[model samples]
Target: MKYYKLGIVALSSSLVLGGIAPIAYAETSIPTNVLAAKTTTSEVMDKERLIERVHELFPGMFEDVREEEFRFDSGRSYGEESELESYGLRFFKELSSDMYVSGRFSFVGENLELVYYSYNNENNEEALFPPQVSKEDAEKIAVSFLNRMTNGSDYQLADNDDELYFYDNQTLTEPVEYNFRFDKVVNDVPVPDQSIRIEVLGSGVVSYYFNELTGKQEVFEKKESLLTESEALDRLKEASNVELQYQIQYERSDDVKAVLTYLPSPKIDGIHGMTGQYYIAGELLDKLPKKEKLKVLSSTPVEKTASITKKEAKEMAEQLLMPKNDFVKLNIEGVNERENYRGQRVYDVEFMYETRNGGSGSSIEIDVDTGELIDYRGGFDERFLGEEDSSRPLAYKNALNKAVDYVEKYASSYVHEVAYPNESDNRQNRYDSDDEEYRFYFPRVKDGTIVNGNGIRVSIAGDGELLGFSIDFDQISDWPSLSEVVSKEEALKDYKDVLQTELQYVSNNNQNEYQANHYKLIYTGEMDKEVLRKYYDAQTGEWTAASSRYDSGKQPSDVTIEHPWAEEELNFMIQAGIIEVENPETFNPDAVITKGDALKVLSKSLSRYYRYERYDYEEQKRQTFKNIDTDHDLYGMIELAIDRGVLEADTENFPLDETITREELAVWYGRILKLTNVADHYEIYKLNMKDSEQVEKANVGYVALVGALEIMTPNEDGYYLPDEEVTLAQLALSNMRLAQEMAEMDIDYR
Candidate 1:
């Protein structure tokens, strides 16, 4: 699998969950060679230890040196004839009497310029060390200078002992620029050629780059012998303000001519954070309006600047096509940040981004100040994208191809395969991390329940990334890492008569219906699914299943099987009193049903006026029905059902007059019994060979009953056997089920 790290800061971290990119960091440590020879890893940790050392070595010092490294000259000096010099180079060489070379022992920094007070203070700039100061005296001078400069601010010092150490004992800091003011007492011939000889002591390490093309200074930042140049540059670049590069070209004359451009430093700037700066030649100014030249120089930062990858741009465009969110802003095009550009450590970067959803080319940004990329999320304007099919960008096409390949190869299989929307959501953002992530939800996706679905529920995660998602699944349905979901005890409560019934394996003769990434699982048990479906309906909401050859728009029928014992063993039938009670109207028939009472007909069994025993009954006016009375045959049954909230009192209750439909029985049995682990023993509706309507209505109940008993197979179109009377033979099996149930349930009724 290809791995991607998201976001600028995220590039430094490992992906955690759902591709959430954490923060990123630039360089944290200097190279080992930049520290003292004896410094250990312990000394180079978080600059805290360095602080303590600073306090001990230079108590009451002003500004603490936060970073220090030793720069060892790997090569030896040649030409010195002194026997002790070991053929070292001569200290003094003369081109003219005016030129003199003198060796002085000091830190690597002398004509050094390192930052102290971060703010711009023209008067506060000072040299890091004196040219001719000795190692010991240099430390004293450094402490004295920084102490005055920092004024006791809370600053951490740097520690570099081993990696940067040289045989010469001295610590090098960064470079600083200062003018030498000390003059010796000896007076010689007055000459303007008096020069300063500075020694880069300690490791004598310094770094500056010269342009290879022109041999001119592109930009030079020199460090003291004690500095780890790369490390120092990293720390400064982390600030949000770092840009790419800057260039200046002009004639010898002050106002001659020129073209200058500046770009944000790529190292510090992330992709899409590019900033650009440019200047016109003075020669052009002479021929053009003064205002024009000034305007060129004062071009404000672009407004809504965006630098998105191709994929992000496309996604944004797609989002626009569908309009998922009313105000979706995906790819950032261009915008200017000015007036008060607080130092928010900006990084200009360059990367390949693809825009989607509905947005222009991409949400790519080009910064004004640094001439570097600001940000680029993916988006394509509908009008722009649809101008012509072939007008689409090659980059976008490639990205789309990759996405399609991913889905085809990894997505779950189903006849109605998921495909990318031709159009995108069109959000506005720049730089969509490193990967093109998305989620395709399927409102109704089915996976067979391998085990008894006792209190079985489903859920979805990776909302915008995972495929085949749904809303009906319980939250935390398959919690992988945490105990935030239902506890094991709570989950176990739902498993009643459920068992480890051999985990019997069955093979399907048909080919796998799903894709390689998807599986079409089917579960089989002694019980039928019809009873479970009916039970679910009654348990939650009161819904009806009309034998419906076809109701909602759907395709032709699928499968069928037979069920027999639903009339008695079905949980709803027991709740409805279809099963004969053993004691005092309690249906104990070898099957365990707690008892003390229950002799009333349920409200569902009748359609007539019925008595509601409640102190506040008179105040509540209910609807009307038929065929029920206080002296009715099922009076106790109805009363018991009402008391348990299983039946609602109405104007008329249909007591004993109405024959129950199989679906109704299943729904009620599952509902009132609260049977979570109902054994799969019912049947599903199926069409006969000829799909006969008369046969469908005549034996529909038997068909449904079989399904309710988990004995029949279900097809796409429900069970069809109608008009068939339920048999006593079928009723006898319900009792056997009751016996098994009685053995497991511990709850007792009065």
Candidate 2:
């Protein structure tokens, strides 16, 4: 996030060398009229006008404060030139006890549109800190702050909101910060990605505030939903699935343990407004077009399977730095051989250097089969930046020349092809340095199309020395010679054909706890991991597959069960198909539930469709539990529970068939609540029973949770009867209650 690139001259020149070309269509597919309407600019505001607007916004906050205006780097670009303009301001105030606070703000134009603002206390002394404020007080402060920024506009508070986080210490000595987020509403519905956040400290002081609003609000098209909420939910549910998977419990050991459970399917945040259907979001890619594949090559190799020895890799790495005289004595740090992500065997070689001046070394990857360079990177010794005899900073052109020479000398035997630099990746560093740092990124192209992940990035310091360099060549042996078969117009048509605009209840996660549905265009094309989808591929006239869908578990066929008391509960579970009985015709409600059966139900209830990595348990069974072996029907679930710390019975004597005690069941359910992050709200209720003392102290949390939820009730004697065995019917009812609670609370199990 360094602001190094400033000069338009250098930025434009580098873009030309980077091989970027103008495209006919908008990359994001946003209509040209929409784009134009959003870019409307106003006349520039003077410093006096900006100051007046600030004073009007806040009546007394700016009194006697030192204020200044300076150029700010607005990180944005349009066409071939930089479109960033700065109208920034800074204000500083010294408090009563000599502790100082500072505030920074940015304005867009004559109307004084505030884009960014932040305030922080400079002193760390505890005595000077302000008094701790309640959550309500913080909300009031946030409202005042937002009201002033928006010039009398108002916002709403989200439910289960007012997040409070403590830093430094949990004790009274540390300060707690409360974050308040508000959204701008249009036609009684919240706008997407347009909101303001006001963070208040314990002192009720506004610490940070940002209004992420852009585009002309007046031009926004507002509409109503064409589909109901139930329809959208159904679509997502049909396409999505919850899976069970084992992850190492990071809170404890690094050793393999299948303790944690997670869902593989991505959940929908809300439905889109325009497209009244369920849609995923791209928070990652935004609306960029998805490339089919990245073309990566290291020239035409002499052989398809040429072997590269460790010694050869070391030598090739050293050659990349030959042109630079800074590296004096170099030693091979380490060399490792492994298959890369593309299934190509490669050698990773690291080299450290004793510089003649003050530079560092290189880490390079070489393709083992073709003896070609995959990537090379090295860091510069920063001490050289301050030295009097350090090399003079090179001009932008000279730096590009050096970078090209380095790549040509060490990368490949074929002519180096330069792909255009990605607009998002292009930036100039401008902080903590004497000169501007220019960065250039170029994809290695073959057969016209730039490969997806194959590229070279070179950064040149103001001193003309290489700041850093990197190259990614996947060693693609063959590439399609001709461009995509489909025409650009055809691809555009395809994109529109598959695009879906849905009425979704979008929550910016700031305001509107009761999310209102908004119409938004959703790409119906293939999505990757989340909601963001890939754009239609011009060559194929089809949207690229974001990723292949996974198969969750399937349910068993319907069966009749006759246990009257547990009939409803059993049927519900059977419909969910997470837990199944061997004999579907009868569910023995009065049967004593064994530890193995209980755990199997719990594990499957949480994550039924999840695939688990099976391990040989012959040794574990012989050394610990004899009742459950590797061949046991419920071995996977029981073992998973044991590894996850849900059950911690004596390993040597696992009573798989023995009826589980009520106390033990409480401990198991308690562990589940903790693992699933269902808050333990157990302190409010008091148990008034003589047998309460019989409940083990370790199982108290579990008992309290179940009791509070009425999942477990006392007997006529008002006794919990902690050690008594529970029947299958009772456990099923409790499990059902807990499942319902999880859904209602919206607790994330994955």
Candidate 3:
């Protein structure tokens, strides 16, 4: 969270979908008093007034559209000093039964200023009506919408440099939707968070979304800098300490061919702007190797040949841990051949220490065809960690020697020109902060350029024993000629002229606020990351592909539930801070849950409290509800639920005070699951439950999904028992299952 001055920009914000972090501004300084005054919520316009405003803006688009109102209980903002009022307008047109197109909007003022807008051509229309328009045609439709809304001025397509992204792999038979984005331009500079995103479905129906932009369009004078571009580039190069790597490029359509190119290593994101001072390093750590780029080799099938024997594999593994004295007895666990991802066979030999100088397990893999050690992992025991005993500690130089000996013995064919101790990998002890382990990385290089993703990682414990080690080499055989490469002087000239600097409003999560500052420029060039583009020719530069946008890491607080319906939802809600898991290890999904817990989950999941504001610890203490007071853990959520109309406002019949029935659960689920009400087709689908007739018509869809989709189940008698109370675990699991089903079914709630 520490903000860098003139260093690597981690860009704390999450990537949207493709792990591509778009350029965004945190905040620009405005007077504190003015910000405080503007933070208050204003009264929402009446439904008629809002509809009139929409009609006024579009003139004809809303003539046949139906409008509805939604109120948010608690307002929320992304950054400091920004909060939205709880009112919004939704417009829709029913194309047929179980099919429709709709748009949602939120306004800014009494004038009904348009702060947001979105449209969706729901119902999988691509199967019935394929898209007649191309990506270019969709762009025109998006532009037309923007022009009509803004009266056609001061806006243009921001991403004209790259072709519009069309996800053809999404479906094979139906036409895929094309999404186009347009950024607002004022005084010839792109406005930070102001843009329009339009989605065009196969039916040629466009769904539009407008990002809420609050500040006035003010032009500031571009200031002259004391530092030159070359100076800034030098500072950037030093800050990033980018290493030159030999990238093995591949192309496969009919035959698989490999071509190695020399260039700088890849990075997480591009450098946005350059500062004058030398920035601190390690804001971003090690660069991951690029993928082989040949997922499916249709014509070139890999041959699995078994030439090396089990004995040879064991001998090579023992050589890796050689020069062992009589006291150090090693035991060979096993040696077996296995098929890799590419359908190639290799020998996997495992071993362990059987002596007093304790260690854990270790493994080594030798290519069955080539008889070369391709991979290795050396492990250590937990006893190696803790304490700062000088008597047992190994010297840094000796540890490095042991690491080098192991690598050279097995991977002697590859050159190792790069070696650095990674300080970031050090695990500090609670008793002694100075006591730390050391991790060293040795990257292979050829013809002066380092090889990407082909290297060895060695770790030395605090007690000086080799903690762990790994060697990875993804089939990098063909090397490219470096004779045609441009000299460093020539590349530096283009780097100096093209590298631009800009004043940006930046914020690191370290501070709760943002400030206007200058930074090194970052962007994705025609080929690679903006940071590595200057290392060589644009076409030949070694670029890393973007990482996954979503973080799939597990959390410690997650409750383990066995039910397929509840596990994912329980984990998601716990991670989102929506549902509390009293016990971290287990969630009692089958046990009957109380009404207070149910309401808290519903309030968090279905209400604005989940989207905008979080549970305010201090604010909950001031709760004054007669039945549910400050002592209750769900005090804040219950209050918001009542305010937002998710629950009844009657204090006498507090939802938190009673146990919830199955029918009541259905009603609450129905409320959040659908944006607009559809006819209850309870009698249309066949009912398997014995007492299905007892289910109310209104709650049929909810109950059906819970039962049919296996989100919830009936008793041994095959009766739904609509009035039966549900457990907290059951509620979470059922909702999570429903969400998954909706996503798979392509249901559009927005």
TM-score of each: 0.15, 0.36, 0.36
Q: What root-mean-square deviation over C-alphas does model 2 reach?
A: 19.5
Cand. 1 TM to true fold = 0.15
Residues 1-750 of candidate 3 have per-residue lDDT tens digits of 111210211121111112322222121222221222222233534566666776786678666665443222122232443333323555455665544656656555345555466555444434221246766887787778677666666776765433322210121213346666676664455544456666666456654455435432223334344354445445445433133245433221111223333332233222333334322221322343332222111123234334678888888777655523454567789998875433347887888766565656667777787675566555433334432345644565666566666555444444333333332222211112132455566655555455554556665555555545555555544565656554544444444444443332222212222332222222212232254212343334423331111211211232545665566556556644556566755646677877887876655453333111224432334453567664455666666554443465546546555788887776665444331132144444455688888887766755654454454668788888898888876776665544543433333222
What are the C-alpha RMSDs, in order, of all predicted structures? 38.1, 19.5, 24.3
159, model 2: CA deviation in Å? 5.7
Q: lDDT at 431 for candidate 1?
A: 13
lDDT of 2 at 244: 24
Q: Show model 2 residue runs off by greater than 4 Å.
A: 1-45, 67-86, 91-100, 124-131, 152-154, 159-174, 215-221, 241-249, 252-750
Per model, state how many residue pairs clash.
Answer: 221, 35, 16
Off by over 4 Å in 1: 1-626, 639-655, 661-664, 673-720, 727-729, 735-750
Off by over 4 Å in 3: 1-75, 83-116, 122-141, 147-153, 163-180, 192-194, 200-205, 212-244, 248-448, 453-473, 479-511, 514-750
TM-score of 3: 0.36
* Tens digits of lDDT, candidate 1, 132-183: 3344554444444444433443222222111211111111112222211111
